[model samples]
Target: MKRSVVVRLLAAGATAATAAAIGLTLQVPQAAAAVGGVTGYATQNGGTTGGAGGQTVQASTGTAIHAALCNRASSSTPIIIQVSGTINHGNTAKVSGSSCNTADGVIELKEISNVTILGVGSGAIFDQVGIHIRDSSNIIIQNVTVRNVKKSGSPTSNGGDAIGMESTVRRVWVDHVTLEASGGESEGYDGLFDMKNDVEYVTLSYSILRNSGRGGLIGSSETDTGSGYITFHHNLYTNIDSRTPLLRGGIAHIYNNHYVSLNESGINSRAGARAKVENNYFKNSKDVLGTFYTDAAGYWQASGNILDNVTWSSPGSDTNPAGPSMPSNTTVSIPYSYSLDAASCVPNVVAATAGANKGLQVSNGSCTPVSPTAGPSASPTRTAGPSPSASPTRSPSTSPTASPNPPSGTNLSLASGAGADGSSKADGTSYGNVRDGSLSTYWSPSGATGDISVKWGSNVTVARAVIREPSGTSGSIGSWQLINYDTGAVLKSGSGAGTITFTATSLKKITFRITSSSGAPKVAEFETYAS
Candidate 1:
């Protein structure tokens, strides 16, 4: 379909990966190896051990991304592209029939293999544009946000899905992303993320789907059952109307996902689709898991799911309750060799690590123990073959630095020493972001009870300690403490992320210990001004 879109060439420089020091990402250690056989989004399709390789370059804008993909299409050399800046498509149209075609505005990874696309810097947002991946393998997309793409009001392809894949796709992993919309197709929005037509072995983890009527789906139609073997774990689905996802005739392992604020139905599995729904947290939703509106029907084996404050729909002829029990139908065994965090801890883990730019701090969070279980088939279902690609980069987290000079004679406390009692997500940037100075960055302790403390080189006069969330952040600090490490005294304590004013005193160190929080408290800056 030809349409009016800005499918242009790119500029010179993009951004770097979020790993240490930026511009480089290494393979995950054995101890840190994740579920889906690979680590980081880059290896989603396939990792360095698979196919993607070559120099890692940064790109910004849809044009730059397209240029990078186009440049690498010939050699088939593995590549990692770190994208920065906001790529605004602005009602652009699709220009090619191939799913991976570069139609200018929307970034398409068509006919590519072993590639990792990461967002860098403050963020990389694809505003009003969708990402299409087709005939590709071993692809990873992380720390990116795609929103506001309208299917009806403007020019788009495949219904303006925030991220869509189809045709001979395999081993694609998407993590720590944010996909949102203001309305459904009637309001010009489609699926947050969708897959179809022979897609398999895909995973979505530690990401978010919000403010849309549709979340995602696999196997576009009942006959398109070739798309299966999908995995979803540790994601947040909120403010969405339906499709907690619509699975059709595929085997999906869905676990540890948080569902909230749904007005319509959720998880409509039908057309012979089967899911093993485990350890999920749901609140204020209706029929969170059941058969689709169609009659073909679906089945699930649910275990360890918390449906707190959720309302169940009446059991109609084709409806089935998805919560609080496991299905009596065929039980799907977990093919992965992995561990699980406790159901109560799912919300905490997801809140701390899901979405872009908070440091991909994946917390173990008090999980129950389990043994390695094999798949139904004796042999391995999938092993990223054909030599692994280069390891993708993780975002480099910068710790807080002491202000060079405090305004009006105040000595900004340089954290000569810093430590956290415990943290949920710890990919470098942890308690130190409080001193990092940039409001765009902040420190979020896993769960709510831990303390992030900063120590000075020597004793200094201190009067006030100020703490606040990043700009446009609504995370609330219910109650917190300002402690003097020298004397082990609580100089001040208060609720909310506002400034904590206390009498100026001499102290060597101060700590910000949070007692309670509404959402994960994001401390952008924890400043202590000298007396």
Candidate 2:
């Protein structure tokens, strides 16, 4: 296992859980009162005006509202505003309030904290970003719906991020915030939430981003200040198209997030940002990431992130490069070079509570280490004798041989196995199969029957034994398929119990699927055969 992976799993998971629990229990605390009678942030009060269906506030203009709200502080005094009717900028969702660009639209903040922004009435339609924070700390933005901020005409030259956060902002919490249609070239911007500058101890949870051109939310660091100690969990990144910007910036923790990118990378961390991309589901991404810079000063860390069943929108070939391409200057080997073992990921309470030091622990979970085992080896214990049944019977084995160069057919076989030491460690609840022996596991879904693991050795197609489930259990040993993990090709498939045998040059790992009828089913003692 790698140190980067272990540290990432702990820090990112804990921070996100803490923020969620805290945010739910203790609503965002109000900012402390302004000190020394300083100027506070302000928002434009567009006076009531008659419209076609209802009366609208003149200040309801995103620019006007932003001008009135930016940089204004509500210290010991909570400055609150109530508005009525729709605030329209453009029709597109990505347009920001800054696009209105009346000099008055820009609100500025300095030396102020303990601020609150709440929406009352139906809340005016937000043509621009509802609120923008800059050079401020101890800030809370909650219970606000920032919607319909498309540019009506053209966009402001530089435009604004729906929630543009810059400068050094610390201990800031944003919750129950809905940012809709806030990104794209039309708005001359990117991302529903863009936060740069020096930011730390910040948490964004329970937030929803929809109909955006780029990332549901985006984070980066100022040129000098490094962006670390940030948590983005429990947030839904949905319906992002080609317009979405990359989801990440500098070093941060991103997990437990359901990211769906119709067109673009699900989550990208560029500019040498170290991140832990874990437990996230991405749909239609060219690659999990474009690149992971592993240079001395820059690089993003990846681990435990499930790349399960992602369908690529466009497949690129060697000659034409229109779709996702393989990573450059990277090695593609049988065993993942820095892969983390399955058992090590879970928690270990004994080690966790005993030391009480800073480390990763899955509160009520424990990680039981499962060592890797190799195939059968040659030894002189048993002498080779023939003519028992006239023709020699195939031997049950694990070791496999490589195929000739440019071999055809799907690749298959076991990659690693239990450790040779055959030792077991039972410090907690979970158990690890430490013993080095012939044991097997199988998956059988309803309406499906058989599955097999095949390997080729010495030009012999060896079919391993079948360890079917106990009899009279209404279990079916058919309807299973063997799939090669790397090339996404089917080696051999069959229905009903029996044996499936195939010969291939080399083997790594194979998957047996039961078509997922109702739920996933498990069987004991799947056979492992070799020739």
Candidate 3:
């Protein structure tokens, strides 16, 4: 048979399955089958085309999945692994090779790239087993169910995370899957989906995460602030106590999701994290959006959301809720393109499209579920702007002194008074080099554009900054933004590197973000002064 004819047949089968799942009366052309694609932030960073144009394999056990990976030609080889049946601890074991890394009692996608795990047939269930992804990129996981994974009990796996990514992971799309736990930490279960330690450019779409103490988290802790650029859309979070999720630091665009029966809190953006929340439905939940359980606050930009029967707790020393009335405190700029379904129809849209064995139905961005082959409806792209109810407040600034040179003051970055972190560092470069006061020792991001920060343990007042390139390596830095990390506020933005003067404002951390660059930029010194 011709390849074109086969492709059409497969697409028709997918359409039929989708129609059946949604109870639509559509003419069937072929038998139903599973299909795959990427969306949201996963479509960025060179695009996550998992296993496209590669070989396809089938697996019914965890060991078989590892065998398929280990049998690949290279670590970067693209392969689609169609999974079915129950994958438990007994059927999972270590299967190691140069192209793959595996461990007993878990499905590990480690130190590899360009892979897809799609559930097929009746279903794919990882019962008491977990999927662990580390040091990998360009991956897709769709139409599967992972449940009852435990951290400190018999048959423990993946530290109790149904699906966890960490340690330099990038560009992962998890769609149309179900991740659930029996109970909370006391019940031996942990986060449903968790990302930490430099993970970036990820999306969780058309999925369900429920019945756990912790839904998930972006960064692991208060100081683990490197991860960012995540999108959570069209997912369902229910019966989770808190941390749905506790974002430590990063930028997350969350829209069109449904939250129900949140026992404690929902969407705990904290430790300098910024969340752009729009068009989501929160029903019978508590403290749906806020910085909670810590003194280190986070910021949010919210709009077009519906809160039904939701309640908020009173403010405390460590808890701040964005409720009783949802207001925008900061503006987050989303780089990618997306369509938002109306909040009024989110519950129905999510219910029909999310979870496994649902034939990969997706919202048309107009409150209707459609076959994946039909594609998402065209809608106006939205960047999180100021809400109509509130505008972002800026800190009081002091006028800069008239000086072509940097203002006469000590460089706050020096004298061991500050620390450094960033999105990613190139091989053989150090984040600390940017603040070490040495022209020869410099820092470069893994790519042309990234973020670097100079943070202090306590708040300090500064008004002037001088971003210096390595000697003889000028003009590498292009357009950039100076952001107050404490409040997710853009203080100064311009092109090139030179003397940058802003109002003297007290802040704990300041970031120099490179949006675009001509080449691999090198920062010899990031000097700050108080005038």
lDDT of 3 by residue, 1-531 (tens): 224323432443534343223221211122223343466667655456666655676777887788668766566666788788899988887766667899999999998877888898999999999999998877889899999999987879999999999997877889999999999999899999999998888989999999999999999889999898888999999999998778988899899999999999999999999999999999998999999989999999999999999999999999899998879999887655566788999999999998888889987767888887765533333433335334334334322222335558799988467988765567688989988878888888766766788999899998888888876787788877787765545677777777788778899888888877998988878888886
lDDT of 1 by residue, 367-434 (tens): 32121122112223233212223221222322222233334554374444533322232234466667
Order of the predicted models by lDDT, top scorer first: 3, 1, 2
Pairwise lDDT winner, candidates 2 and 3: 3
- TM-score of decoy 2: 0.40
- Name the weakest run of 10 consecutive residues (lDDT summed) in model 1: 1-10
Better of 1 and 2 by lDDT: 1
TM-score of 1: 0.60
Full-model lDDT for every candidate: 0.65, 0.36, 0.81
Give the Å shift of residue 249 in candidate 2: 6.1
Score candidate 3 by TM-score against the native. Answer: 0.69
* Pairs with backbone N, CA or C atoms under 3 Å apart (clashes), candidate 3: 398-504
Which of candidates 1 and 3 is the stronger one according to TM-score? 3
- Arrange candidates by TM-score, highest first: which order? 3, 1, 2
